[model samples]
Target: MRTQTTPPAAPPVRATGRPGRALPLAAVLLAVFVVPMSISGTAVALPGIGADTQAGLAPLQWVVNAFNVAFACFTLVWGSVADIVGRVRAFAAGAAVYAVASAASALATDVLWLDGARALAGIGGAAIFSCGAAIIATAFDGPARARAFALFGTVAGVGVALGPSLAGLLVQGLGWRWVFAVHAAALLLVLLAVPAVAGAVPADGGSGARLDLPGSALFVVAMVLLTTAIVQGSQWGWVSPGVLGLFAAALAVLAVFAVVEDRREHPMLDLSVLRDRRFVGLCLVPVAASFGFVTLLSHLPSYLTAAAGRDTAAAGLIMLLLTAPVLICPMLAAKLVTRGIPALTLIHVSLGCLVVGDLALTLFSPDVKILAVALPMLVTGAGMGLSAGLVDGQALELIDPAKAGMAAGFLNTLRLGSEAIAVAVYGSALATALGTRVDNGIGDHAGASHADLVAARAAGGDLARAAELSGAVDTEGFVRFLARSYDSAFHTVLWGLAAVCAVLCAVIAVLLRGGSGRNSRPAPAGNSPGDRGV
Candidate 1:
């Protein structure tokens, strides 16, 4: 008998119609923009929302964090679900849900209602975001894919940069509720784009994988507990039972998740991915970079307005300087990357700039000009742009194409998880620092009050003498003292973040060999088995 030989399967066909090709990319970009914009845009309106609804600081924190926590927890599951079911279907469902949730938020009567709506929005956002890169991956190949990724990055950068300034305008012109209402309009655009894209792509015909139910539950529990502890720890005290219990629960659940995933045949996250030294190194950059980036973004607006005593609108405009670099740098970075510049180099450069930016801001005195404040922001933005795409690209490079969905899911999960932790951790740090400064100022004033009382008593308790003694007290001193104290506290937090950025840069330097060296290896025939088109 003759020996039989079999040919390899052909590469999967890519959809090519104009509507089919363009719609998914448009939908994904729009959806991505909405998520960050919604958070940043509404930030300017928080005081108004709080006063209107009589919500406390804790509730206000949840208004922002609920969406982040939900999105972070559900991202991987939804990404996997999109791969299993069909990307178009998943995208549509998420868009619809997000739209409704935005409307619900606009109409919310109380903090609980608004928070629930935000959580639902997060679920919807996860579904859309989880599949975003995969959709781009499937739609374009090679250089086209790189360009698409760059364009997507640019859109995200613009949205984030514009969100706060836009919100400030809206809050001044319309009302706080309109911020949520605007998202509803954006969602409608996504809804229209989804069907156009779905029509072009072939339906997902592969076997639907089992939902990682146990893993999903544990991940959600871990994230919620971790976020809760960070946000509430300052209020409740770090060692309070509520905070400690939450932290303990988060760790225990996460530990269980690792063991469960390691043993499962169809794990949500492939543990082997972590073993890739190069990939692991790239991942750490995002964790550290995000922590530092968020620390600046979260606190800078308040610093500009309150510490600098600028008008809110002026502060919002100053924030634009920070965002402008995010928009501009990615296009430049993409060109450099394609010219065979190492991704690791870009990562290091970005982190280094972040450190410099944070240090600059920390050294900002009350007399520092707005331009001085804006300079650090520009440096930070460039760093962010350089590091933004490294994690996803590196993760995809390590895994087989068949496991692209899972890898994408895991990468997003890590990114979102890092973001959530960054916000919580940095927010706690700022709050603690500010509180201590305020307390010390109040303590120093106690003696001044005591001296005034003694002077009044020595005057035989005459009302005129008491008034004269009170007038003699240095009231302006207290105002200046409070301002100086706040400045010191703000600087302390920025310096701490600068230290974080330095550590991150060091870690990336140690772990990542130059991408240029890796690219010099000969290209494989056809697509590399591990390479997805995007």
Candidate 2:
């Protein structure tokens, strides 16, 4: 008689061969980290920039949107270029461009100059992000690949989580300019390290790769017009000809792109990716998650300042409760994936937790303790952690490895585009909620318009200014009314968005039940489970 025990599974092998193995990963992380850092940090510095430049709300909004618009429009183009020109070259060049732009931005005295610099920075960011993902994908495999992606994703989250707090310190210690200045210095270091760390890879440009100029033009025009309409809708009137026209133009351009892409021999955006439902589900993950995260980033700091009576730094610290999970959770999720747990299951659970977290936040009132305000954010943060690299990992898994850069670009486009729309949609929702309250509470209030109320809110609900515009008899009474109305709007939007996330989770859960599609299992480069992307 012999007693036999099964041996433990062997650890997955790591990919090797490069100028320096760790250099590629470091460059990727640096690129990923800086983009989100710049985006999120800028959010914190908006007030400071406004104070310094004496810019109005419209100009300040442009300062933020300029970066987004450029990032959204050109990311795909850069991704394609990365594949053709070589990842390292594209990445290093992008970092240099970003550094120069950051330096210029730091010196900007006027809002227009700052906005232009930010837009240039966004183009550079697009290059870094698109190439960075491809470099990581090509540089690693199996469990190591998962870990690399996890770290990459974690750094992105960490950048966002740390951005506000870090920016607060820089703005407080030095000035708003120092925020961009520090970024410039860091990027310069990345540039100097690039040559030594990034090994050469042959350009894949000879693969009959043709740039889809028409497709690119159409998409850029659509995105620019659509984003402009959404961002300005609350102030400009949603039904105004300008807003309506922009929407129409965007839709028409998108339709043309669809037709052009479908017919093109070498399409910029391969429509084939959309055939897989699971792949589409994975793409939606970032979009849905961002709606919650970006919404908070846009509003929570202001809420903490005006509603909770906290300073900028303290507000950012409080936000750590919501963002800290991002720092640690992705690695944990990767571990779970390595242990044979389904990534989709984790994703569903993550969204469920997010829904719960948002619902919990609705319980918060002006009188609620700080601890109460911070606790629910932990739940949302946890949800974010459990689903860290899931979206990007799954997305890469779905596409051709050679098109890694384009896949990354496409995925990010969806995420960033959703964020742009979410900001506007959320703003509109808040406006609607406030309007309902105003109509009911102060009927026929002189000079009261939806635009005025929203503008008042943008000004942190200044009672005196609102009173001056609306001709309210009692400034204090109006202030209190506005505060309550804003609070209600905040809760309503969160709850509504949470419900939407929950629905998305449900759909994904059903799609993933029993077994995930072909790419369900994580495997090394040579041993991928199936060619059919899940």
The candidate scoring highest on lDDT is 2
lDDT of predicted model 1? 0.69
Off by over 4 Å in 2: 1-14, 200-208, 308-314, 371-375, 443-455, 458-475, 510-534
- The CA lDDT at 92 in model 1 is 77
Evaluate model 2: give its lDDT: 0.74
Model 2, 5-30: lDDT tens per residue? Answer: 22332232233333445665675687
lDDT of 1 by residue, 1-534 (tens): 222222232343354433435556677889888887886677778888898899987888788878887887787777767766777677778888899999999999898999999999989888776677666655654444555667777776677678887887888899889998999899999898876666545554423777677877777788788877866775687789999999999999989988887776666665766766666676677677676776566667666654565666776677777777888777776666666665556667888888887777665776787666778878877777766654455455555544556666677777777776676666666656655655444555533443324222221212233323434355555545545655677788777877877887777677675443233221332344223323
Cα lDDT, all candidates: 0.69, 0.74
Residue pairs in steric clash, candidate 2? none
RMSD of every candidate to native, in Å, equals 7.5, 7.5
Error of 2 at 517 (Å): 5.5
Q: 51 in model 1: Cα distance from truth in Å?
A: 4.4
